[model samples]
Target: MAALSGLAVTGGTIAACTGKAKPQVQGKLLGPSFKAGHLLRKGINVVPTETEEQEVVIVGGGASGLAAARWLKKHSDKNILLLELENETGGNSAAGKNEQTAYPWGAHYLPLPNNSFTELLDFLQETNVITGYDAKGLPIYNEYYLCFDPEERLYINNYWQEGLVPRWGVPENDLQQIERFQQLTEELKQAKGIDGKYAFDIPVDHSSADAQYRDLDQLTMLEWLQQHELTSEYLHWYVDYACRDDFGSALAHTSAWAGIHYFASRKAEASNSEPHRILTWPEGNNWLVQRLRESCTDRIRTNAMVYRVGEQDGKVAVDYMDLRTQKYKRILAEQCIMATPQFVNQRLLSALPELLSTRNLQSFEYVPWLVANLTLKDVPHGKGLSLCWDNVIYGSKSLGYVYANHQQVALFPEKKTITFYHALADEAPAAARGKAYGSSYEDWKAVVLQELEKAHPGIQEQVEQLDVWVWGHGMIYPKPGFIWSEDRQQAGAPYQNKLYFAHTDLSGISVFEEAFYRGITAARQLLNTERA
Candidate 1:
């Protein structure tokens, strides 16, 4: 998920919408085929019914996998095959469309790239996100992709505010605290380490290793905030919200380094828009996912569930099932890129247990999430400022929703799609994940309705369809001491020059840029080894 920069504000009293009893909305409770993955829990014994060969095999078709395939296609001519478990290549970036409009199931936006990340900028340019560069060398973003006006608003104190950083009706003291926090973020944004590198880098791995900044990884974000004596209730809420928004972890659970990186790592400037503005589509990041898939589409095999990967003789062996045919396949390749997450890799690489240590894998933690897309019969009515791309309800456990069609030129349409996101960050991961996976559709419908009622009053009746998606292992969380730990480094290393690893989890934070970088890094490793 793309995380916006930090915010600050004033505390206030508010009232809740009391009228809605869960309206019987029509829709399906949809999720990943958990059965496909659960097969690994117990042993899946199968003999290969067919054999195949490839110069390189890329496993797991998420962002990292797709990117790895894209890079390999660009830099090398090895016969490559990309296997995806789902029918589509996008993982968290997957999207769906109904009669009303296109909508995202998970990650929805891409913040403008830092100028230093040339590769990311290049990809954006290739996809027409960065249409061109101005004489000053700043990127001129495509107007159509830039988040439209009325970018975001927050429902607070029973009133809607124009911006997310709550300033309306705030006391002078609260405003002072908010201003101080803003100043701190600005200073940190430019701060560099003694090693002549930014203290926080977007890909995260490129950050300076200077102890001055690395030491911050030892403490939680909340601890860091307390140490700096920046404890306004509003500031804390906003900080916590930002943490959960990006990291899927609470302020107390997120590493200070990771939290600070959230605000400081982005320094992207645009010729056509503000640096803070982000790019989005009706289908969210899925638009970019499709862009990445264009060149490598022919090489991708969907519904391929790879169960095992290991070194055999002098090559890599990958065993997978073609869900479409219910047949098994074994592919041998000169090199393999396991672009899957460590959680899945734990089982896939079990045949070669020596490749990973239990401790190293345990250091990686992921959080669960619940995303719902509701098609409303009419535009939602709310107090204050008009509807925007992103809307949040103050004090709600949910992260709120995004108007999927906000960018449409048509106004006040008969129907509109809005995607809601709720990170299970309020409790222990185990309990939250259990509830997410175990809860029935009715249970979640009630939850979704309750959160929406906070801002929309008795508007549940307007909901035509409410489809829910559960990301049980949504994304990696950057815990205290994990981001800069040696374990993280070890987990991402190449194995025997035959298998390479890539995933945002290896970076201790899940982001599009990180996933893209890891894929590029893994491909580069393989290409470099081939040359050697």
Candidate 2:
């Protein structure tokens, strides 16, 4: 990424889903810096005309990069610089704003954290997410941050249901199966392994190392359900939705351990909220990114892409370009953190593949995703429930939409905006990405209208503006054998005691907590090595 290499440019604007005299929908197709990413394949031959030195340098301005910078500044007096390819730094946790409200571009919400993750809890407290602790030592979360009432609703049985679990029109047998499955997951949430560790943990690495659980990583989530005889169509649909929602893969494609972790990994509790309660804002996790950024804004450099990272003169040499000015610069750091994805890392560190000798870069599989934020005059009420924070269609291709203003304290809004999500997981990653990149506004607008038209018959006419963002490689999913694989561990290991790696992919799951920890992990490693 040279200058604004991956800035979300308006691909095009069109009169969307309109005919005759209908007030035409407006907005442009904006997406990740896939163009800049594409340029990486062409190769780099850079001789920097400018050079600088830093005690530590961070490459990539995503959650991990920002977090690492935030932590390093708190603990070290060393010079540090964070290079980001895009005009903005949040990465998937990024956000945007319109007159109506703020909405998420990628990751939207963070569930209640496991209380035992004290570092995360501390960050939350520092950010005012956790107000204080209760008498029992449980966190007293800010009530405003906890999702307001009517938290989730499912459009099923031609009506809206109170919660996501299938109940309304499901057959009695299916309902029984759903209840049984819930019980099983709840049990798994508490179940530990022979090694005396929780069967599933949020970060995945801290989970039980016992082979019984590790073997589960080898099977597809579908295989696990089949073995358990939980064959209810509704149950499978719910499970698949969870897999796609969190892991961005289908039931058969997602590893069983990862799928189970979707349900079992969440054990967060708060005195003011229910177990697994979520904390959200109008801007989604971008609010968290803002909090993380607050501690280290001065250290971040936007529109700066590190094209090459190698060792030079006993230090890590990072060659980057300022996309805005077409100027090249180099930063020689005593230590560095590579927070970019392996897809990019494989190219930047190509000269020293030995640094990643133990890792199979090709083994990592990232899925493409579509997020559309539509500002509408109003959302039509389905049969049973009104607009809720999180909404989903029972058996739809899209993940439904979230009312972006759901967390707002405003009793009545002049307009409503909903952020819709879709994972292109019906096909292989290559095919899905091809479709997403090739599709235009007309192609995408039709898909959004089709999904929404069923629930709200005339939603197309209510549209004021429609903005689309495409994630070419949304998040790394845990495929069969990928999570527990040796490569995952090796991928995160330090190189030459001078370079360290930090990214959600290294953990094989792209939750906010994981990314936050990935940053801290790398920062601590760098700090500990320096102490040595």
Off by over 4 Å in 1: 1-23
In model 2, state the lDDT of residue 332. Answer: 86
| Model 1 per-residue lDDT at 381 | 73
Candidate 1 C-alpha lDDT tens digits along 77-192: 88899998998988899899998688999889999989999999999999888899999999999999999999999999888898888676777887788788889888888988
Prediction 2 global C-alpha lDDT: 0.86
lDDT of 2 by residue, 370-461 (tens): 89999998898779988899999988757899999898878789999999998877777877777678878766766776777767877767
Candidate 1 residue-wise lDDT at 530? 88
Query: Which residue runs does candidate 2 get wrong by more than 4 Å?
Result: 1-22
Report, for every candidate in turn, its global Cα lDDT versus the true structure: 0.85, 0.86
> Would you give me the overall lDDT of model 1?
0.85
